[model samples]
Target: MRSSVVQLAHARLLIVGGGAGGLGAASKFARKLPQNSVAIIEPSERHYYQPGFTFVGAGELRLADNQRNEEDLIPSKVKWYKNAAKRLVPENNSVILDNGDTLTYDYLVIACGIQPRFDLIKGAPEALQLEGSGVCSIYLPHLAEKTHREIQAFKSGNAIFTFPAGPIKCAGAPQKIMYLADEIFRKRGVRDAAKIDYYTSLPKIFGVEKYAQALDKVVKAKDITLHARTVLKEIRLNTKSAIFDVYNAEGKPSGETIESKFTLLHVAPVCRPIATVSECSSLVDAAGFVDVDPETLQSRKFTNVFAIGDTANTPNAKTAAAVSGQLGTLEVNLKAAMNGKPLGSKYDGYASCPLLVGGNKVILAEFTPKGPLETLPVNQAVPRSVSYLLKRYIMQPLYWHGLVKGYWNGPTTIRKILHFGRSN
Candidate 1:
């Protein structure tokens, strides 16, 4: 028997996924729409501050510090559906939930964040589960503490970190953890005995040139070996080894395998779009990401639909800072579509990554397509203690209180003021 359908005709706004992006949109829409006119569909009881996971993995922050009850962050005015979205029916402007109920909305915001695919890598799932197996990942919330444990148990040998070939939530994270691990190893008196290596499928350390140059210096100074254009193929738990496939200039596998032994293996697993978003072939792009105008964040096919965060196929780095920058544009465009008006606000592709380089310092890599877009007037490429403090103290509180509450719209305005109106 088909489950009874619950029609919400008065629900003007339906935001999928209750992460930073969805919650931010919900908070904004709740102010404009009626008390029960906004709805958010999210199954998870605990909402994680994903950026803090790196710190948790580094043992600098506790796992509990990065999490909050889902009920606390979501606005009380918006109707909260503690359910998973099974499918997105754009033609009907409705979403099918796992409970077999249907939710129809006038305007939809798809923020169903990326899902980590650990099963894609051979032996990865099994390796991650085996305690003290020398395999760990900081990408998942549960694995952060495990990664810290792995780092703590490391006595010597290769401390290897692998970065996936595809787009990840935080592009800087894989390396950030590596830097933290380097510091940890040194503190534990295993630095001299261990060989630190970062194997990434990307051609460069970072996408932006300014920060990449700074990172190159750090890599050289720390004696860290960077193997670029390398993809992780398999993990041998029994031997504590990892296999890699090298890629050529054409991005094809070279059919060469490099087996490296490790006392600690940190893998940044490949990320894919959630089933609800990717299953809707009409809604996604060739890469399985929600196809939207990068600037306006409005869907090309459905005017009433918009996407933000990791789900959207935007050129900007997928981060909370990017979502914060995108919220204003998405809100303006979404509201305009409902009111039959043109989208006035535009996103400048602004994204910031507070690159933790150890030693109580961070290189704040803020950028757009045009190039290095720094918030402070000083050169942000260099590591500074102030940037680290901003990432730890200021950003955390701001994300929970300001951004998720829809009070913050990124650091663009602050950047402009600090740069004396020269900021892009």
Candidate 2:
């Protein structure tokens, strides 16, 4: 991009996002690398701990808890463009910003996060405008606070939560809100009056088997309707009804529109990587996610480019926890790659889904590429108050002090050492 040079060994690292993964990678790399080595390409002024918003919607957490000023989260050592990258010229190792500025880099970190598209659902294009309308989603941070208010005012009837038929950030978020609704209704003596329905296109409650089994029990015990393989087609705002195309066991169109009247509707909208990054089909996978090695966190095509968080095509469920783990791997591998050496870092596809079952209980689901990788020595499936307390109070401090500051990865090593410390 800068010249015909094969490498800038002195090259500046450019990042394309400002969210958890983007900022986390910049924080780690900027702190670890030499002076003026990293530049993050982000447009937003506020950084959000998106996972926390799920709890915020359920009224389990105050709406204010999910935010941090973007300036505060960024490390002072790196350059902050504070502009959206309009396009990626990866072959040239350059990016063009929406403000008509071109940035050239020796190595690039495509940390641009996924975008939720509510328009995929017919008639749902104007969903956000219906702020007080029955259609609401926890995925949008700005609506999370309103969702709490909407749920709190619910009297009775169908309280529906729908999961779109595609990859979404924080995969368990739809049901997390549903679980919160359950707790809220029960708390308000309205559980009996409301019928909680989890209408998802996914075949299971949670992707990982261990947590899915646990969630299955919770749904059954709570008497919530679990509709698997069901897809939402449209919503009639005037009539206050939803039209769903229900599929049969064969995953075919054994369907007709099933209209359900709703006192509340919660959805985790379908998502895709940002358009700037999406245009580079060479870097993306089938679902328009940047393709990367699950373990190494390196781009499959370009060695100099790596991605973390919701943008990457890695199999792990997108979460800030996963980004924390990937940051460790990417930092190690990036440093090694810079020296023309073999990759030293290995990301185990570590991801966690901290399912807030209720006000005081949580199911901490931690797993890696191989299989169920639990953090707690005891069962992580069953909801526990300890997990709840950690998620609510301790995790935030740990995130700001450790993860965002480039010290903590996932809880993998801590769990292993503590479990085997006395034995070994």
Candidate 3:
């Protein structure tokens, strides 16, 4: 145990979690505010491009390529408190740190990302640790590497992928890995011997209708088995089996179990808000996400506080692209509050997910609350090789250099220009 006085520090603005959203917010505020006015609370040494993990699992990119030292990416003017938030005291405008320090802020931004709960499923944590267990996941950095190894070693038997029953970051990721695995098996001349299955809790392959229709064709053409409304209940590592509880038409458990034996099992575990956000009952909704006005990104109760990225209770796909779109809204609202002005800007719940159908193809699904808000004028529902190239070459560099530096705010400008000033 450690002991120290609860030292207090004050900041003009405090941002939690130094992930994509936090870094973007920091860069924007650091340019406008005085030196040390903005403080970011993040304990991790390295910042990962979480969107790249699926590519790493597919053996297309190395794990190290997606990581950078946390300090290097943070703006020089902002203070970086090398600590994790333990509790959020919204009433006092203070945040308690694990190291016995209290930070009080005039304004707060909760960007703390989602936490993957492997422990939620019985035998999952232990099964993930077992050697040669054939259980792997791309959601975690370490497990992503393990998934690539499992793919390379697989010679036969079932290759199963799962999507849990909840709102998850990058909703397209569960099927992306399945398609990559299919391509890998075909290239290895073992496609016939191995059976590929995608088990998801959602009734549809994707949320957007246009993209879901296209994905349906891809699923059929690839001959991948689709199991809908099936939730993984447990993993039997010793027997290499995955047990699922089937759901009826009324969305209740059917009291029936489906067991599948696998040589490789990839799981996208259930995700929940981090402890700091979840435990703050007054600050969050019933789902443990920060309760904010969706369009304004402002807290309903505390006018000085806001949330962005996966932590915000917005009905948008929790992707890095969503964070990119949210940056502008959060910035405008926070600055408006500081200046005692009404917030004029509103976010349209924009989000994008470049669904990697295979190594060479991608369905660039971009949408807002209304419908598909594509950047290009062409029909984007169909999978194309150029989209895959864009995902590989364009997005990564833009995220590291432009977004973190506070320049990129999604492709809204490009979309407007391409569509002849059409808002949709």
Candidate 4:
């Protein structure tokens, strides 16, 4: 155990978590506010472009290519606190840091990202550690390369992928890897010997109707088995089998547990609100996420506090693209609150997912809570080589030079231009 004296610090604006949302929002405010007015609490030394992890698993990009030094990303004008938030005291506008320091802010931004709970599933943590155990997940940086290894080593038998219950950062990731693996299996001339299965807790293959309809066809064409309303319950590493609980369309368990053996398992483990956000009951909803108005991105209780990215309990899908969409709204609202003006800007719940189906083709799924909000004039539901090129070539640069640097505000302008100013 360690002991230290508690100290108090203050900032005009405080941001937590150095991930996509934190850096994106911080960069904008760091430039607008006075020097040292904006402060960020982040402990990690490396910042990862998590959206590229699917490509890493598919051997398209190395994990190193998707990572940058955390120090390099923080804006020069902002004060950097090499610390982690332990608790959020929103009522007092203060946050307790892991180093026994309390930071009080005039305005707060909770960008702490979601946490992947590997311990939730019995035997999962141990299974991932076992060498050649055939169990891997791309959610963690350390495990991503191992997932590629597992895919390369798999010659035959069942190749299983899973999507867990509740909201995950990228809802399509579990199956994205599955699609890429399917292409790899065919290329390696082992398609006939291998059996691919996708187990998801959702009632359908995808949430959005248009994308779901298209994905269903792709599943059928590829002869891939999809088990809907089903979730992984446990991993029997000794027997190389998994136990799953099946649910009905009504979202209730059917009291049926099925076990299947697999030669390769790619588990997208259950994700929940990180400890700092969840532990602060005042800041979170019943689901342990920062409870903010979906449109304004402002906290329901505290006017000076706001949330963005995966941490916010918004209706939009939790993706980096969603953060980019929310950035403008969050910035405007925070400024309005600071200046004592009514918040006029509203977020449309925009989010995008470049679903890499297979073989230089990607189904660019862009949507909100209502329906597909595609940027391009073409129907985004259909997989195309152009979409793949966008995901492969353009997205990474846009994320680094555009999004995190605070210049990219999503594809709203591009969408309107593509439609000749016909749409919003």
lDDT of 1 by residue, 1-424 (tens): 2112334443688999999999999999889987879989988888999999999999989989989988888887888888899999999989988988888988899999898898988999999998999899999988989999999999988999998888788989999999999999889888999999999898988889999999999999899999999988899998988999998888788998799998899999889998778889999998899999999999989988999999999999888999999998888888888899999999999999999999989999999877888889889999999999999899999999988998889988888898778764
TM-score of 1: 0.97
Q: Rate the local accuracy (lDDT) of all candidates.
A: 0.90, 0.81, 0.90, 0.90
List TM-scores for all candidates, in order.
0.97, 0.93, 0.97, 0.97
Candidate 4 residue-wise lDDT, 158-200, digit = tens: 9999999887879989989999999999999998999999999
The alpha-carbon lDDT assigned to residue 149 of candidate 3 equals: 88
Output the worst ten-in-a-row residue range by lDDT, candidate 2. Answer: 1-10
Give lDDT for model 3: 0.90
Return the candidate ranking by lDDT, descending: 4, 1, 3, 2
lDDT of 2 at 374: 78
Root-mean-square deviation of every model: 2.7, 4.1, 2.6, 2.7
Clashing pairs in 4: none
lDDT of 2 by residue, 1-424 (tens): 1111122223379988887777778888887788778888778887777778877887767767778888887888777786788988888888887877788898898888898888888777675566677677888887888788889888888899898776788887788788888888898999899988888776787778888899999999899999887888888888888888877776655657678888888867888988887888888887788889888888999999998888988887787788888888988898888889999887877888788887678998888755677766789899999998888888877777787777778776787786885311
Error of 3 at 59 (Å): 0.9
Off by over 4 Å in 2: 1-11, 248-255, 421-424
